[model samples]
Target: MVKVSIFGSTGTIGKNVAFTLAREDTVDEIVMVARPESLDKVKGETYDMYDALAARDIDCRLTPTCNFHDIEGSAIVLISAGIPREKGMKRLDLAVPNAKIVAYYSRQVAKYAPDAIILVATNPVDVMTTIALEASKFDKMKVFGVGNHLDSLRLKNYFSRHININSSEVHTRVVGEHGDHMVPLLSSTTIGGIPLKYFVEYVDLDITGLVERLKNAGNTIISKKGATEYGPAYAISNLISTIITDTHKVLTVSCYLDGEIENVEDVSLGVPAVISKRGLEMIVPIHMNDIEKRNFMKAAETVREATYEVKEHMNM
Candidate 1:
């Protein structure tokens, strides 16, 4: 039986992820952890989820706690505990405070769940992922951030809508930062196994507008709802399912690079990686246009600078 532990279970994303994972037959148990002050909120969520599970006839076990030690026996540790992005704030703005929180829990996870795969969902996720990897001292493959995976999904959704095709027929990805500087790999985008550019020749697609919308997608939702819940929650659960099912699918996620792609070293950026039961199997190098390559390099620098700031705070 596979058990997963979620930190910051009281948050919107955490709660939604808990519900989503609970419905998976492969997930036998879920441990939800929140700060001491929010323990009641997690307990309420657990009871609420139990009712929902009973209605569906699912047998997934649920445990709620304020204790970090209870995270033991977890196969996957999801860290979503941090101050969420505000209406007008950039993801990078939450770096230091969130990094401290992530670092504290990362150390505890290292101690309590040494062999678990760490999935980080904190804002400025690219930086926070690097922080988790460093603080936990976990293998790079065992620690990653759910970064461009959502952005890639957004891109896929856009292509599907514009081309009037099922979303599963579109294959595309957004790389680099999970924020403003993210690069849409149009060069590699495909629809029905054909290059997107080929379809562009026959379809009237506004490439510029689509990319702009993709970049602003998160803030657009946050400006109205104060937080993005379902989209990220589902996206995270999808990645976890891939790992738990041992599917060697290539997905874009923030992972540490040690001179892996284009000689880029010592930073975690969203790149295509093969995810399986062991976490990342390999980082797949995709073809990028000259302009896309430049934009990607810039995005790397953007994340690297923010990561440096948080590293200073942690004195790493």
Candidate 2:
């Protein structure tokens, strides 16, 4: 039985995660934590959410608290507490403020849930993951962001819809930051070991155009709904399941490069990794051609700049 704790469990992504995990048999406990200032509000909100879930017969031991000790001994710790990006606001625009928030909570997480796998869901996630990892001083493998998984899923969805095929049949990946600089590997995408091009001639598939769309998919959803929830919420829950089950699945996730890719190190960016309870057990760098390598490097540079910006913000 795995015990998980969500630091921002009253928000859209947080509530969805709480509700989803409440029904999972493997999840023995769920602790929904909020910032100290919003303790009462978050507790009330969690109670209401639990009531609603109970109405649907989704039962699990869900506890909401503002105490840091409640997060201790957690098998997984999810940091999703941050502001959403508004229209016209870039993901990098959120770097400074969200980094401070992530770093503060990361220290608390370090002190309490020292051994828990830290999963960051905050925006400009690559930057936030870097801040969290540095602040917590945890093993790099145990800290990651959920951005790449969602981005890759969006890429797979695009291919699935275009060819009228099940999404699971397509194997593709999106790397780098979770924003405009996201790199989609289209040149080598395959479906069940067959090249993607074999089926995409159905229409003049614009690879670059599709990548641009994949980069903006979150913004599009934010425009439609006040926030983008389902994809990210499901992405976090899926990762939790992956870690708890020790599936060691090779999924794209945002983590510090270390020697995973050329010219990108000490900065957090999305890359394919084998994930399990031991955290990112392996780096599965997707084979990138010359052009794809250039794109991925460009994306890595963008994240590197954001990390520098975060450092500047901290000094200020």
lDDT string for model 2 (1-316, tens) is 5789998787888878877777565687899998677777777866776787677676667877989999888999999888878876798888888898889989999999999999999988999998999999999999999868998998898877876779889988888778887878877789867876775665567776788788788778878877888788888888899999999898889888877777578789888899988999988857788887897888888888879878887973
Task: State the lDDT of candidate 1 residue by residue for 1-316, as single tens digits.
Answer: 8999999899999999999999876799999998888888889999999999998899999899988788998899999999999888999999999999999999999999999999999989999999999999999999999989999999999999878899999988999999999999999888999998898888899999999999999999999988899999999999999999998999999999987788788889999999999999999987889999899899888899889988987799
Deviation from native of the Cα of residue 270 in model 1, angstroms:
0.3
| Model 2 steric clash pairs | none
lDDT of each: 0.93, 0.84
> Against the hidden true structure, what lDDT does model 2 obtain?
0.84
Off by over 4 Å in 2: 52-58, 202-204
Clashing pairs in 1: none
